[model samples]
Target: MPKMKTKSSAKKRFKVSATGKVIGSQAGKQHGMIKRSNKFLRNARGTTALSAPDAKIIKGFMPYDR
Candidate 1:
């Protein structure tokens, strides 16, 4: 059988944590910073874990991540 390939886009955007959770970056921080409060920007820093239902779908795209 041929080897299953991981989705390049998913690989770049999502990460599999040590505990098997799918990690992803926060949204709404890419642009329009002028209107956003300073506290919102400060709190948005760093990645966050995806919900189980959502992560399960994303995980399908990462075939070789295991």
Candidate 2:
């Protein structure tokens, strides 16, 4: 059988932790930061785990992970 490839876009944007959680960057951090409040900027600085439904979908794209 042929190897299933990981989705290139998913690989770049998401991370799977050792415990099987999906970790990703917060939104609104990509551009136009000047208009955002300090709190928004502070809150957008870390990775967050995906919800169960979201994780399930992402799992398909990340073939090597659960």
- Collision count for each candidate, in order: 0, 0
lDDT (C-alpha) at residue 14 in model 1: 96
- TM-score of each prediction: 0.88, 0.85
* Position 46, candidate 1: lDDT: 96
C-alpha lDDT of all candidate models, in order: 0.91, 0.91
Residue 54 lDDT, candidate 2, scale 0-100: 91
- Candidate 2 lDDT, tens digit per residue, 1-51? 999999999999999999999998888888999999999999888889989
lDDT value for model 1: 0.91
Those runs of model 2 whose alpha carbons end farther than 4 Å from true positions after fitting are none
Best by TM-score: 1
RMSD of each: 1.1, 1.2
